[model samples]
Target: MRRYTARLLGFLAVSAIAAFIGAGAYVYYGGYDTSALQQHSEPVYRVLQYVRERSILARSDFDTPDLTSLDWQHAGLMNYETYCRQCHGAPGRAPDSFSLGMKPAPTAIAELARKRSPQELYEVIEQGIKMTGMPAWAYRLNQAEMWQLVALVKQIANMTHADYDNYLVQAQEESPQQTETRPRRSEEIASATELPTMEGLSRIDAGRVAMQQYNCTSCHMIPGVTAARNQVGPPLGGITQRSYIAGLLEYSDNNLIKWIRFPTTVDKDTLMPDLGVSQVHAEAMLAYLKSVE
Candidate 1:
């Protein structure tokens, strides 16, 4: 009886080893497909999806702030329009043609935001998912801005079609002029051509134009500018009066341009996003800021 049991154990161990070797050999010969365009088979998809979902659930630790305080819907909408809308799409808009070519196509994330937790949303935004075109903004946007983006996405999730359309229009129209307080005299009001009829704008005029165009006052309160008042970001009313930019960067012309164009490089958690400001725009904005101070 003992001899029979030993023989049976030996047969099982040999079979297991043979199975392991066969599987290794199959893998070594390139039996698996590795194409970005190919949709993962059911088994692969299920496993990957499970891992992604679980990892986000387990790793996400960001706190969801009071979205109302930021009134951040407009602040977020600008960047979303400039950056995310092309890939994730708006509530009523369709994604671009190239987004479809991806193996697992990007969804209209404004709708997807409804199904996700804020922490998970932040994780995805701050650190983009691998094997997809969704770029991370950890370097481009600060923590507060990231949360604001999340907040706007949450609103987008629950909006009706008309509400979305109106909201989008309103958000896009959130210009500095809306916050105008005292009446402006004809000469006091800055016009598109008030500075000079020259080819290039002076530094101060350039800065003023860029700030107004980008709606810098949406998050801050510049002394002379008409802008929505919010405590989310500080006022640059007398930026030159201060010694630093965003309380960290040195107060210099070169530094100001660098911050304007690539703030993420300056402060990883800055509320500012790289709106892809050109060298000319950055210089103009800097000139305006310096002149005002």
Candidate 2:
């Protein structure tokens, strides 16, 4: 009887090893096609579907924090245009061709958003999943911006194309102008020259306040400025440190200003708007942004 029991245990162990070997072989031998153009197999598709549902359900249990006065819709619109629209697309628009090639292709969040709670959305934005094109945003954005994105995702489900365009217009209108010639008071210029020592509050903090006041954080993911973990536009964490403005333009104050003022001319497909930023305010904001390490 003891011999029979030992043999049974050995059989079980051998069976487990065989199963592991077979699964590994199938994966390593390229038995499955991984092209995005091809539909996922039943098992793979079911796993992804389960992950999507379960992750949302598990993360949704947390209490959503208060953001009573924040106008996230405006912030989201700008973010969407700057970062998300190319991949996720807006109402009546389709995602770009390259986005379609992504293995799990970026979904139009506007349609899928109704099913997720705010916290779930936030988790996805902040943590990001492995082996997916999605990037983890915790390192690049602050908590407030992440929450703003959650709010925007929730609101996007019912928005129309016109509504999105109108919000974009509002964001553009809020951008500071570049041509105003206000005389700097002597004291202000002297203080500026002295480079008032910054403490406790970082440039990021000041930028955050400026973002909120100007509604810049309402749209794009301004790293260190807002708390949203959105990928709506390229992260703005090290904009000042970049050696180039866009991928093509050489980085310079003039180039940055020109890009900000005339994004369309720089790149016809560029989504950035002429925000009408005045020269002085733009310079101040740029200085603050560049100061960020």
Candidate 3:
């Protein structure tokens, strides 16, 4: 019995090691295509869908607002036109050509609305799904605006293309300025500088959210953030221990804030753009950077 048990353990250990080595080789050899043009395999797609659904279900503990009012629905319609239509498409419309190219392409919003509860929709709109090109709108849209978006989504499934067009026309007439133009990036950055203090979140947490909002991960590899592996700039894992900011300014809270808000002023030759980070947000970002090590 002892001999048999010893043999069984040895086989299990060998199998585990072999599986690990195979996985490593597969990764190292680039066994899978990662281009957005390539779709996920059926098994991988199903697994990801399952995980996404479960994650949403687990976190969708929101209390739905009274979304039955026409006022709320109209507000939702306008917001949808501004923020959602480009990616998710509308009744009798297709998503933008660029969005159609996304791997695991943006899901049909009408279908999602038809199947999911209001709370589920709200959570998705507010928090966003990671790695799926969905952005968390919490930083951009206020609570009421997000809830209004949910209200619009709830009504989308029933609307035909004509119905949507009619509603959109009415919404446009009601709020001409709201849907007529989108805010520019410079305006957005300037507004961020003047943003009121964020409630509930710690400084570091707020900073992390600010990092995402500012698209910092597109250039710098920040610890504890996803899709932050771009090598355009230096990795920030040990930024706190580093002697300098942007290899010019000495590392300190004031210097870091100045660099973050006005990178061009600090280094005219550097590629880093001035993101107009707020003093509060800069401090928050600094706190997160210091804590990373």
lDDT of 1: 0.69
| Model 3 misplaced regions, further than 4 Å | 69-74, 183-200, 221-231, 234-270, 274-280, 290-293
Ranking by TM-score: 3, 2, 1
- Shift of residue 254 alpha carbon in model 2, Å: 29
Best-matching candidate per lDDT: 3
lDDT of 2 by residue, 157-209 (tens): 88887876676677767743412323222222222321211223455454444
lDDT of 3 by residue, 1-293 (tens): 99999999999999999999999999899997788778888999999999999999998885766888535557778778778888999999888788988877898988987998988988888788988998877666667777888888878878899999898888888887776846333334344442422567888888877887878999999998888379899898988787898879888878887888789998898999987566667778888887797
Give each model a TM-score: 0.53, 0.55, 0.81
Best-to-worst order by lDDT is 3, 1, 2
List ranges where model 1 is wrong by over 4 Å. 1-30, 175-293
Stretch of 10 with least lDDT, candidate 1: 180-189
Per-residue accuracy of model 1 over 177-280 as CA lDDT, tens digit each: 43322322222222233222113555666566557655577787776577668667877768766788888888887887788778898889888876666565
**Off by more than 4 A, model 2:** 1-4, 176-293
**Pairs with steric clashes in candidate 3:** none
